[model samples]
Target chain A: MTPVAPLMLLLLRVTSPCDTGTRVVLVPFERLALPSADARELEEATRRAVAAMPDACLESREDTLARLRGSGDALAACGDAECRSAQASALGASKLVRGVALGVGGKRSVALTVTDARGTEARAQFEAPATAPGEADARAKKALEQVWSPRTTARATREPQGSRMLPKVLWGAGGAALLAGVGFGLASRSTESKLSKNGGECATAGESFAACFSSQLRKGRNQARTSNVLLGVGALLGAGGAVSFIWELP
Target chain B: MPLPLRRTLTLGVLLLASSAASAGPAQVHYALIVASNTGTEKSQAPLNYADDDGARYYELFAPRSREVVLLSVLDAETQALHPGLAAKTRPPTRPAMEAALTRLNARMAEDRVKGDVPVLTFVFVGHGKRGAAGEGAVSLLDGPLTRTDLYARVIAPSKASFLQLIVDACDSYFFVHSRGALPVGPAYAEAVKGLLSDRALARYPQVGVVLSTSSERESHEWSAIRSGVFSHLVRSALSGAGDVNGDGKVDYAELRAFVAAASQGIDDVRGQPDVFIQPPAQDRAFALTDLKDVSSLGYLLVPTGLSGRLWVEDARGIRLVELHKERERPLVVSLPVGKGYYLRSRGREATFSITRASEVVEAGGLPWHDVSVASRGAAQDAMRDKLFSVPFGPRFYQGYMASLGIPQPVDEAEADAALVP
Candidate 1:
């Protein structure tokens, strides 16, 4: 009925939720059955935490409360994305944040939901020791982190897809073979070059020369053999790739 | 580059990078490749493949040469609005060639300032004729360049320690010799003696020369090679086929022998190739190219056991190089390397690394990609008069890149403007 309410609906209907905008309306936290709490101020603490987001601009307390009061019992209590989206559409806001808190035993648990016009919603919950004062704000930070995470946004739109493991296994095997082949091939060439310059046999002049000559001969032979095997494995994968390529040939 | 003033402007895109000097290991190579198909106003017939052969030279030297520039007159077929063609847009006149040389010299000057060694080579493939004064002159796009002009312009100002001049044309022997045309048997000896007496070349310690003709004869063009007979033979020699001693290096003797063998079993004349080489106070062979150094030189590793002769093709699917391996020979032979070449033999196509890096691309690791078979005649038809013909090759590009791409430019000015970021 209000003129601004109709204008807000036009904005919400035209603009996508993907655009970065600051339109957050938080209906202050409420207890399960009490019209008002005689105890500590929990709603104000929740409001402070949600407003801390870099892209968030909270609605005036008077406007948010007046809209909530008009809803009466038909949809007075809303917790789902559809219900929250409707509330945001009417206010021409981009997002609506709503939450509840309760106490059991020595701990108090809190839950919050943030919904946008795209029918996407994210929720976060946390529990803290109720014996301490100001636990609402203390637990608010943790709950807000869960709501703002990229994974949470992805989870709302689709089922998390899992990657196939077989291709990864093949890639790992091929990469390992290539690494081993290069290492052994380099070692074989280095030793061959050295033995070509100096005689294969050790000189009588020094122990280092003699040991180096004997060591290179054996090591070079071993490396040459190792290099051949690794190269063979790499070739097998290349052949496999070739087969797949041929399958698609015209 | 589109130049507004010329009749048929050829692109001479110069891609240069200032490389760091790591003591003496790094040597900057600069090349000026010129190809002129049209002759002077009233003299010679227009050559069919002159500019294309120049492009072939550009492709061959690209992998090894760092600072490469092309000075050519590209026809409509090869130009295809290529983005690389820009700068000094005039025809290959004497002044145009001089301007190109000046730009290259200024670039190499920076390299010398950075403590890097410079090596320069001049390659010209075109018409050669005798001027009215009886002096030998090679055709430029707009005119002819005389021998005296060449000495004064190309060689005199070059500061490179190692210099090579390769000219493939009818009257090329006149560049260094006093004769107006290539000479015959005993006259060839006299010509060499005359070249040795030249004062300017004698002052240069390290210099090598390869002239296509030794006597006044037609610079024959053979259709089989798709290039002039002399240049094709010389290129064939550089492909390791000329390494008669299996020394892994193609030197002056090896190249001369290869050219002679091509004309073997003939009637009266042997193929004539002239060489004038002087080492820089060192008696090392005038090694033109190395086949074994894959890191510096482009090479392909062909395994021992491949049956039949292996034929290689360029990126355009045009067969260019060939190889045949026997078991009695070494276990592997290094295949001649160029940019974007394919190995095809017996229905099998080889895929290997051609990047300028140290990794050895083993024969065993080559991936075989299946391709649709075309008849031998179709393969032969694919070779002539093409620019960037790899579209029919195995890359099989589906034509997708960025979401918003610039449309192809319509004119030279727009083409140059599109190159800007």
Candidate 2:
């Protein structure tokens, strides 16, 4: 009885979820002018990285490609998240990893996307020198490490309040202030013109020139002051509004 | 003449006429392209690439069009670069433009009499200014072609089924639509509103407009590319890279999206060009260029497995069809088949030639050669590096279409067929 029990326990341990791990199929990396050897090396580095993860298992590239071919879907065709997820399900794996290796403009960039059967996706990108395949290999592994972790759930729950509307309101208020300033400036100019034209006539009536035009002068000065203040405020507000609007742009 | 012979001849002539009538009416395309380096005012600096841009457009459209009238005074450099094209163009004066329009309209009228469909495309690439009265005007050799003049001469006199107007210049928005009070911030929103409310343009439902600058912003030219930024993009779009859905036709929306994506990576706001594109009011799906109709141009196919920022340069070093390709989608760019061209991506380039019309060269099969790196100043690098940095593929197309609140114009089966393994 003791021997049978121990043997059954050993079998149970072999079949445990922790032992078998999660099956992940890594699709071949889509290459753009990348040397075949470098692309494969980068892919292998990524595989080693994923294998190093706890409770993670990787399917071979040959097996994955065979399944994809048999299913009549090429690796390049599975570009969207949904397609990748479907491929993952079809392969009887819980996760799929895909990537693209680009060699252009004397620079090399690798981007990886990991999608699970539940349609959750994570992406990572890294750039390395085209001459250094080793650097690219290291970066590819680092990128895999980044995407393998669970995404943070602490995203901001609500959009910034009045981020857009505030700019519009500021602009509107500034525009109104500018219009009012223009009205006041025009009034002041008109008063000055009238006073200049009639000042001689007022002086001829036997009063001092300053005394004769005091009221008109006071009105013009007050209007000019108000216009200046309003114009300054309007200009400030307009500038603030422009800065805020540009800052809020996505 | 014998009675039997006369009767037979009469019957044959009647049958021939009936067959000709039964055959569908021919669809003729006409283009009038005007480029001016000099402005009407002395303060306006002479542009370096306006004539070159016009000549490139002529090269693109001449083979496909039934008749293309080019109005430009090509400089020595431009003429040397594009051999024999200078002889085909007239001086870019108002009177020459008017005469060309008259002739095109007469031909269109004749086509109409013969029950044919005629399409007119008018292109202007040069300096433009906003007047004190907030009116927009483009420079010509004789004088400015104001918004009113455009409405009266180009739109009103056209008898075509569609009239496509492409203006690449500063303040082109005001050239196409009148502006009211100047806005404090960016004037894009105001310009669009003005365009929609313009009564003159509203009257001509067949008229479509594509302008370089949507506001008072200056349209910039890149000496590296040797063309106005917006004009180059437009020419590339018309050449077939802008056929987003692989529909073999480029529409207004596609062209707009293409230009936006191509220029989105520019970090400097001053360097960025805001484009305004509106299709004919009567037909939202009016195509600017039909690839099927352009049989004289050759195509280069960018198949799957190749991706990244790529450009095609002709033998004269004129960069055409700059785009960021994606691995999943295949793209086709049309070009003149007479010259050899190079397809370049970053450090690698491949040369190919199209010897005949309607030729499609498979770019993936070409032998690529490694290019040596050249050191450039940061400013030049910034300007050159940002072009086509954003990927133009299905994802961008889907997002753009979603933003526009319009259905994606792709046939799933056809799109799948367009993809190459």
Candidate 3:
């Protein structure tokens, strides 16, 4: 039997704008029969995610290419008719919403070369079945970095409004950080509860550290005090991160 | 019944023709049946019994409103009474049942379906359960077949010299399990070949047999309209529907198909009947042709010249012996010892046997002796093959076209190879 080639990258882009400037989206398309079948499901998933973007102007070539390339809206042709039409089509908004979303679910086995026709540049291939949610975003970010790298003088002709990083990237990152913080806080709280319950018992149970700490000597009390302070500090940090995300919401 | 009779007669004729055209009349076939039912259960009141080949198969059922009937046509085209057997529709009594069984055994011992015939068949039908000693157990009757009594009376006495037994029972194979783990597929076929080995059959070779289980041991719910497990299988196998091979007759090999098809209603448990031939005391009578009506009279010299043959021939175009002339004379022929011979005669009926008399020939010089009168069809078949041609060339082939004696064209080759000087 032939071993399958490992995935190098996976790009998952979403355009939902319900609470924040950008949504930290998921691109779980690894449960299909094969790559081709996966692509079909992925396309549907992407369309649904994009159409759900709240308050975001839909565009075709402009927004999609910009998001994929990570170009800011300031660089896009704001009043150009051709650019507007292209962008609208890319975002799948000019016509009535098809209401149907393309769904993709399968493992991508090999590296696929996706090229931008207008830019005449070969984009990096992202291996699917990404290791984790962050891994997929990391790959997408890397691909964008490659496209807009300072070393590369040439850029794609069409730039859309939705993909402009000034608002979207900041918002997406802020939300992801907020979720991560809340997750950490919840985890810490649970751990603290467990620790408190065991604190007194541990000393009586003859556990060396707990016994020594439970003696209530000035030194041991100081050590416990320090640990509590650290936990409090961590909680504070988590709250601050959550507030920053709320501040970034559009 | 009429159709079956016509078919039987036609088959008789065809067999005679094929034998005469093929090799000698020595085609070894057999039937082995194991019946174990005393009809003691209330639901299984009456037991129906028939002796085929040398084995007695019992079909047991409840007899209440009506009398049970047993209609049988033996291999010789003769109607015989089933002495000690009781049908479900008949009254139940040990004495009556024993008497019937005794009479059947007596008849079988008294007469024999002699000669080298093309094929032998045995069929039995009776009420049976799915498994042994379990809820929803399988049985031929509501009760059980006593193994000891069966072995002593039915099995030992009437074992067909060369015939195959076609059995239809739900848990019929429960006994084989007592014997050990059966090899996959059909154990019956292997057992048959093993039992009737050329060496064994040469010494014996009575008849070939096949049995089919209508229902499995775990299944086979009692059915008022449908026959018992054994009867169901027998009927289906004979209907040509179960004929896996294109051969006109459903031989032992086709039995698996019957068993498989019948297994649907018969739970997961499967049963295969036993088949093998018994050693004959003398060379089996093989009917080369069927001389019907006046022909039979003429062939047997029954004061009617309409049918039958004066003599049977061997491979060398040599007349083996005059048949149907008067008495049952043993026509002996000289053959290499330890080899098999195909016996054929005017009737399509035939069997095979080994030469124990140091030579292939009977006590007399010829290879065959005839005791029964022949029909017209039987005579034609005999004339085709029995009229021998040359020493060793293709006389057998010519005889094959005519369809007369045994020693088929193929067998001649085998015989020549097996011949010991």
Q: Each model's TM-score, in the order given?
A: 0.46, 0.60, 0.26
Q: Every model's DockQ, to 2 decimals?
A: 0.01, 0.02, 0.00
Give me the candidate number with maximum lDDT.
2
Which runs of model 2 end up more than 4 angstroms from their true locations?
A1-74, A77-250, B1-26, B181-185, B189-191, B194-198, B214-219, B373-376, B406-421
Of the two candidates 2 and 3, the one with more favorable TM-score, higher being better, is 2
DockQ (C-alpha) of model 1? Answer: 0.01
A4-47 in candidate 1: lDDT tens per residue? 35434444444333333566777555332112241124556667
Candidate 3, residues A1-250, lDDT tens digits: the string is 1010110011124353322222122211211112234443433434343344333333343333344334222112212223333332343332211111111111121111121212222223233342343343344334334432212312232332333344444455555655655555555555455446655334465648554544434444454555555555555555665666465442
Supply candidate 1's per-residue lDDT for B300. 46
Model 1 chain B weakest lDDT span, ten residues long: B392-401
User: How well is each residue in A146-221 modelled by candidate 2, as lDDT tens digits?
Assistant: 6674331011112324347768988998998898899999999988888888673465756476776887788899
Give the proportion of true interface contacts each model preserves, from 0 to 1: 0.00, 0.05, 0.00
Task: Mark the regions of model 1 whose C-alpha exceeds 4 Å error after superposition.
Answer: A1-250, B1-25, B80-90, B132-134, B180-200, B214-219, B239-249, B262-286, B290-298, B303-311, B322-421
Candidates ranked by DockQ: 2, 1, 3
Task: Give DockQ: model 3.
Answer: 0.00
Give the C-alpha lDDT of model 2.
0.73
